[model samples]
Each structure stands twice: as structure tokens, then as C-alpha cells.
Target: MCQPPAVALSLTVSVLAESESASAALVVPHSPVGHHTDLDALRAWAQHCDVVTFDHEHVPQEVLAALAADGVELHPSPDALVYAQDKLAMRERLTALGLPCPRWTRARTAEEVEAFAAEVGWPLVVKAPRGGYDGKGVQVCREPAEVEPWLSGVGEGGLADGLLLEEAVDFTRELSIMVGRSPSGQAAAWPVVETVQEGGINTEVLAPAPGLDPDLATSLTEGALRIAGELGVTGVMAVEVFEVTRVGPDGGTRAAYLVNELAMRPHNSGHWTIDGSVTSQFEQHLRAVLDLPLGDPSARDAWTASANVLGGDYAELYGTYKHLMARDPGLKIHLYGKGVRPGRKLGHVTVYGGRSGDLHSLEALRERARHAADYLQGVVTE
Candidate 1:
């Protein structure tokens, strides 16, 4: 999506939202996500921009500390994006950086969520540490009267300073690494995808994740480049892991990985690196927020699967685009021109090199990217 021989520019804050149909000399219009609390219109849109980024991480760390006190230039700064915009400050800074988290806490009473669910037991996981997404402020309580309407504020907001719980991980899937630092610290990683969630969004991904374990994909790309160099992160961070699978002590079978969420932008599990890597987590997040020099996230195929195209009851997705481009002429679809509801996310479909690219089978690249995303979400038709 960072197209053109890259000289980018598409800033949005949805001034009448028309999802990136670029060219109006490259769309601009700021102030919308959380309604930018005007600081001289974010310092006149960072004095006509030279560097300032974000496609989500709900900006507003005091409007990125008043555009870094007016000097602007924020590629992940804002204290490394408040650990991807607060989830109880990303589980207290990834459990004080020892990482491998998921047995968390922070209840604020329903008697501290029934004493942290009687010491972490009953179907835990509660969340809402500031504006949740996809799964919407999460929940899965299993009792404590379902966290009494988010601690009696009914629809969140009266969360009354409380909600974060955890301890539901039994994972054996959901991976995703994607790095790319820069702003001089230079970094780069990729290949470590597997996603595929459902009600909580993210429908499919797969990439270098089919049977991973090349030393656990080099320890999940060196722990996502050490959490993008201990959080000084510049651009493109992604990192949502949780692959667990235990049993050792000579009994055989082991693999562990945690750290479940964090995305400083350019995700959807690296959208299968656009067309399957060799550079493209949106051009390495525009060459690491314009610090330049960064590319080659490797994988130009051996398998690349993508798939997400949620919105349903198909509102004429170009009438099945000539039968999904004559039935997968090397499928690639993208779409996002918004306006469609039921479980939103309106586009995605990538499929590359399989069946002669020698099906490096993951169910043959997830049945050819879920049959071109279930025939562009009309949910199959031949």
C-alpha cells in the first residue's frame, strides 16, 4: 500500500473518509482518530509534514506530546507509542521487560474481579485498557457476573479505572513477527506469520509460518529485534505471538513463545508483505519512517497466504471480479474502499506460488487463500 516509486503521502484522519483512493496530490486531511484535541491543529499538521507517522496506535499521547513539543518528527516516539497505546501500559512494559507474559492483573474491584478470578482460574481474560479493537474491549469472564457490566459503567467509560485480567493462553497457534526499526537504529525482520483468528477478527495469514521452528524462526526474529530495540522503536513493529505447546522432560514435544500484542502500525500480520516480501511491510514502513535504508524482509514465495475480506452479504464486490480474476490468475485482490458492515474489514486476498510453485502445503496454502477469501466474501459460489 505504500505504492508509487515511493515519494509517499496519504495522511488521513478521515476528513470524510474515502479510504485511500490516493491522488488529490496524495490525500491529506488530519484530525479524527479520537478527534485530535487541537494543538494549533497539531502544529499546523506538523508544519506541513516532513515526518510524522501512524496508521493507528490511536494517536493522542497529548497529541504526541504536542508534536514533540512542536519540533514534530515522530516515528513511534511518544515514548515508543505508549507501548502500543496502553493495554495497562502493555502489561506493565511487557511485565517489566522480562517478556513472556500472560498471567496478568489489574482489576479495580468486582472485589478485584473476584480476587483475580479466585487466583486465575475460571475462563479469565477481561481487557479494556483503553479503547480496544476488533474483539471490542474483550471479555470471556465465565462468572463474577461477567465483570458486572465492565465494573458497573455498563458500556465501558465507567471502567472506574479497572480491567485488564488475563490467563487464557493455551495457544498452539497465532504467530506474527514483522520488524523494521530505522530512524538510525536500523533493524529488519519478517517471516514468522500464522495468525488466522475468527470472531476476534484477523481471518488468515500463514506466510513463513507453515510448520515454523527453524530454531523457532530464529527465536521469533530475535524477539522482534528485541522489541524494536527496547522500545525506541521507529516504525513497523507488529509482534503478536503466543505459540505455546509444551511437554518435555524427555517426553518430547516443546515450543514456547509469548508476548501477545503490540502493533506500531502496518499490520494485518504484514498483509503477507504485500505480495510476499523482499521488502514490503508497506515498504518497510516507508523505509523506517524515512530514516531510509531498509528492505528485503526475504520470502518472495515458497508460500504466501493472506485471506481477510470480512464484510458480508456481499454488496457487489464488483460482481465477483470476473470470477475472482478468472479463478485465481495468481490471486492478489486488496480493496478497502470502505462502506460495508457486519464484521467490517473490507478486503484482502494474496495467494502466491503454489501448485507448481510446488505447494509448500499448509493445506496447500490454506486452500488457495481460502478460495479467494470465500469468493470475495460472498462466501463461495463455485
Candidate 2:
């Protein structure tokens, strides 16, 4: 039998749920919870934990490496995480591996970016080489003129340089596959999820996506697994993909999926797992990092979907949650403790129990999600 420690861990907003898990043991500063990014403070806090992981990709690799050097266990070692941290490096490595990816190039100057655009044509995608998350560092340029501002960067340190440009992918839709691997190299994967993006941000995710062909789902999962293995990822990873309709070499309609981005930890798209699958992403993350046996990633039902409530105005939303629950008591909600802005992920509403014949139409589900979102934004009252 093991006794619980007085304090178990220290974490920023990203690992709030993990910090609260009974298995991990909750630990916090003497002061109340708020944004605390001090490296020294983080190091001291992490030292007390059995192992350390991340909720975001923004942490400095050097800092993580230092922690590892000091005998602190950091999963998905800095070496592995670098691929997720640097956009150019990831694209270059994946390209080298002969993976299917959108045409992309790195630019150190505005002139170079313009040149790349000239070759790829207008309506391009521009991204920061580092420190960009959500929809922050991504820019869709219809012409060369729209490229310079994103190339300049945007943040507290002013515009960052060294950006990457990719040819806009004209795809049917986007999908995400979540892969989880243990430190021992044992791996597991969840259902391929169909992700709906609005304004460059993910607004909803459907598991065992409606009308998803089994072959396509198989291909997506295999691609996700291969990528995780190649990267030697030690924990959970979510691979964002683009499903494109294109002419095959034989010249006929064929469905193709291309890798879009990589996330090294639990992801928003996996939120549906809480109600839809036997093992949720958060629990799987803990198992992988702790070197414990992996759990079954099977779907609990035929289908499940999660809709995110973006923007601020939690007060109104909080007030209406009871009403929503009153109507659909089975709905599962996960709210993040963060200051919300327009298009920011504040919380999510998940609904399961859908099957092939009696499926909830996408629009109907979207309406329920929208009503909740509106209620949260104070646009609607109970």
C-alpha cells in the first residue's frame, strides 16, 4: 500500500485535470491558481513529481532537456518533441520520410516567401516556425500581399521572423487521429475523428465519423500510428489530417488524406472520448506517461460527437447549463479553467448514444451545441 504525499505535483492551466486526478495527487502553490510561467518555479514543482509531461508545445526544449539531465523524467523527450515545436523541422522530417503532406517551404525573408507563393500560386498558408497555437500563428493568404503581415509574426515580443508557407490544400474535410504510446513502446489508437474547423479553429469533432468508409478510417489510423512510431512519441499524440478528393494516378475519383499538424499531448478533438469511448484521452495520457499498461481504446457506442463552446461569458453559460442538463441529462460537459476570448475554447458539450440507424443528424447536434454556446455568450437566456 502506498501513502499519498502532502503534495503531488505542480502544473499550469494545461494539466489542470491531471493535477486534479486522484492517481496523480493534486498539488498547488500557497497562492491561488493563476498564470505562473517562471522556469525556476516550474522546475522546483516538477522535481517533486514522479514524471513530468506537458499540456502545450510552447515550453522551451532546452528547459525540458535540463530537467531530464537532472534526472527528472520527461516523456516524449525534448529530442522527440522538437519535431512538434518547430514547424519547418516537422515539415522537413515528414517530407524526408516520404509522407503525404501539403507542398510547403520555409522563408527567412518576405522576398523568399513571395517567391514560394509565386510558384504555388495565391491562397497560401503561412505559419510561424515556433510558438504558435490554436489559430494564432496561422494566416491564409489569397495573394502575395496577404503574406507579409503573418511573416512579421504577432505576439508580446512583436512579430516573429522565420515563417513557413504551404500551398492551400483544397480538401473535402479535416480529420484528427489520436495515438497513444507507453514508455515501453507499446501503442494504442482511438477512432479516427472528423474535425470541423471554423475560422481556422476546431469547433466540433465526431468519433467514428458519420459516413466514414472503413478503408479510409483504416488508412488514417495506420498513418497516425506510423507517424507516432517514427517520432518515437512516448505519450499521446493527435495527428490532424486533410481528406482530399483527387484524381488517382489511373485518373478517377479517389479519397486521400494528408497530414496537417501534430499535437504531442491530449487534444481538444479527443474530448468525445470522455463519453464515447471506453478509455478517455486524459486517462490514457496518464497511463502512457506513468509507464502503466495501456487501456482499451474501443468506442463505447457506434458514434459520438463533441461540440466546443468558444468565446467568453461563462456566467450566462453557467446559468443555462442546468436547463440544458434538465433537457438532456446525459450530455457530458468539460469546461476549461481559462480566460476566454472570441473563438477561444472555453468548454465543450459531448453527446453519445448515436448509432447507424438512429443517428443524430449533424445539424441537430450542431443546434444543441450552438444553443449552449449562445447561452454561454449571453446571447440567449434560459
TM-score, candidate number 1:
0.32
lDDT of 2 at 197: 88
lDDT tens per residue, model 2, 228-337: 88888888999998998879778887777888999898898888887778878877787788788888999887667688888755543466667778877777776665
Cα lDDT tens digits for candidate 1, 308-354: 98888887588888987997787888876666776688878887665
User: How badly does each model clash, as a count of residue pairs?
Assistant: 1, 0
Report how far residue 311 has shifted in candidate 2, in Å: 2.5
Clashes of 1: 1
What ranges in model 1 sit over 4 Å off?
Answer: 1-36, 43-45, 54-56, 60-123, 129-146, 149-151, 158-167, 170-178, 181-187, 190-214, 222-234, 238-243, 247-251, 265-287, 295-382
lDDT of 1 at 202: 87
Q: What are the per-model C-alpha RMSD values against the true structure?
A: 20.1, 4.8
| lDDT for each candidate structure | 0.77, 0.74
Q: Give the range where candidate 2 is weakest over 10 consecutive residues by summed lDDT.
A: 1-10
